[model samples]
Target chain A: EAGVAQSPRYKIIEKRQSVAFWCNPISGHATLYWYQQILGQGPKLLIQFQNNGVVDDSQLPKDRFSAERLKGVDSTLKIQPAKLEDSAVYLCASSPAQSLHFGNGTRLTVT
Target chain B: AQSVAQPEDQVNVAEGNPLTVKCTYSVSGNPYLFWYVQYPNRGLQFLLKYITGDNLVKGSYGFEAEFNKSQTSFHLKKPSALVSDSALYFCAVRDGVNQGGKLIFGQGTELSVKP
Candidate 1:
């Protein structure tokens, strides 16, 4: 029973640069999610996917943030021209049932 | 709109003593409540969930939560705290009717168990 896997545990980029975070969900999981957690705050949902199709992304910033889950097993979240305010931890979670299992997350530091 | 509230920003308890972390939720119809713990630099781990049935639900790591429908509260408890129990605790809730079943999370409470 391996947990959800995320890549590049930490990332640092200058403002206006592009950064991307990748997530590989657990085996046989049908739902995947992306969340952003700022320091001292709880994680906020960015996007959610049920299989290869998106379920909800209303909170996502369409101007600069985009995400895709091509095969329904793995997903990527991309931020174009990242802003300083974007400095936060990006968490990837997967769920086979109602309960979610989270990954270690990627800490993004925007300079 | 569904929402969760963790009123305390931090809580401190001595090892071997009882510990309690407060949580409250608001949602239409029945609520699906959950508790999760997050260690420093790590992601959230599920501690417990209260969907239906018993008001008191036990979970991993000797943790338990009491769900009170009258008060609309779900508080995490431990009979004897350990230093290892220190972490950030989150309270979340989901509306029963939402198609995506997205959870609404509280701000999180930092629990410190001093040895």
Candidate 2:
């Protein structure tokens, strides 16, 4: 089976700009997750989705970070007014009830 | 809350020597432990996991981990290290107490194999 897919493998934008990353989870996986990985650190869960509905987003910065998993399949994470600190890798993962499979991720650089 | 810890920031070893990357975790309920390897510019690749039963689980590429419940540790081990094995290793956990399929990951341990 194919792994999770992510678009725009790399992106560079100025601060205060808006950027969006897209993810396509594995077929039939009910759970999808978005994670932010700053350099020299672990990946942090920004949001989680069960089907088309959100299950968790407590760590998400609601003011600027937003994510949607529409139609219970694909997801999109957007960061409006991207901050300098927002420069990191945006990872997408999906699970079939156990361990998650991850994508190559989009490396976002906010200048 | 559930969390994971990789005590060592990095581990250095020779190509033919044994290697171990330490990991410990905290969870409220039944603990599910996993190991993942990440190469530069690539996504994490699953290594092995401990769901239940065997304390020792074998995984891809001659990698294995021992789940020590008493010590609350799950450490990755390989008998003979390869230069190609150099990468970042992460420890992750999912707990029944946490709910859902959420996973908490460790900061990661960088492994370097010298020839």
Candidate 3:
């Protein structure tokens, strides 16, 4: 079985520039998630989608970040007016039940 | 609030020796614990999980985690560690109150198996 898939494994953008990351979860997986992993820390859940409907996004910074899962299969996370502090890896994961399978992640570098 | 904690920043063990990475959790209800491994520049790989019915859960790559309910801890363990086992280990938890199954992760522990 294929694992979760993400695009543009690495990204570089200037501060205040907008950027987007894409994720295509494992086949038949009903739950999708986006997480931000800063250096020296664990992955923090940014948002969660259960079949194209958002389940949780309390930790997400609404002022700058947004995500959507259209059709429940693929999702996109966007950061507008990116900040230097936003330089981190954006990881996408999918879960059928308890255990989650993750993609390689998009490492964003904001200069 | 649900949270997971990895008390140690790094754990070092020699090859062929036993290894342990400590983790503790806080939750208001029954806890669903998990362990994941991440190599450099890579995403996390599911190692094991403790939902119920098992205190000791064996997982991929000869790794295992023992969930101690009383202690509120789930520590990852490996017998006869290999150098290839070196990686960052994360402990995560989900609580019954959270219907979404969104995980709260620990800060992560770096494991180094020296050959």
Q: Looking at the true structure's interface, with contacts defined as alpha carbon pairs within 8 Å between chains A and B, what fraction does model 2 recover?
A: 0.71
Predicted complex 3: CAPRI docking category: high
Candidate 1 vs 3: which has more DockQ: 3
DockQ of each: 0.74, 0.79, 0.83
**Which TM-score values does chain B get in all models?**
0.97, 0.96, 0.96
Which regions of candidate 1 are displaced past 4 Å? none
Error of model 2, residue B114, in angstroms:
0.8
Instruction: Please state what fraction of the native interface contacts candidate 1 reproduces.
Output: 0.63
Report the error of model 3 at residue B38, Å: 0.1
Instruction: Determine the C-alpha RMSD for candidate 2 after optimal superposition of all C-alphas.
Output: 0.9
| Candidate 2 residue lDDT tens string, A1-111 | 999999999999999999999999999999999999999999999999999999989999999999998799999999998999999999999998778999999999999
Q: lDDT at B56 for candidate 2?
A: 95
Candidate 1 local lDDT, residue B55: 95
> Distance (Å) between predicted and true CA of A97, model 3?
0.8
lDDT (Cα, 0-100) at A24 in candidate 1: 95
Tens-digit lDDT track for model 1 on A1-111?
889999999999999999999999999999999999999998999999999999989899989999999988999999998999999999999988778899999999999
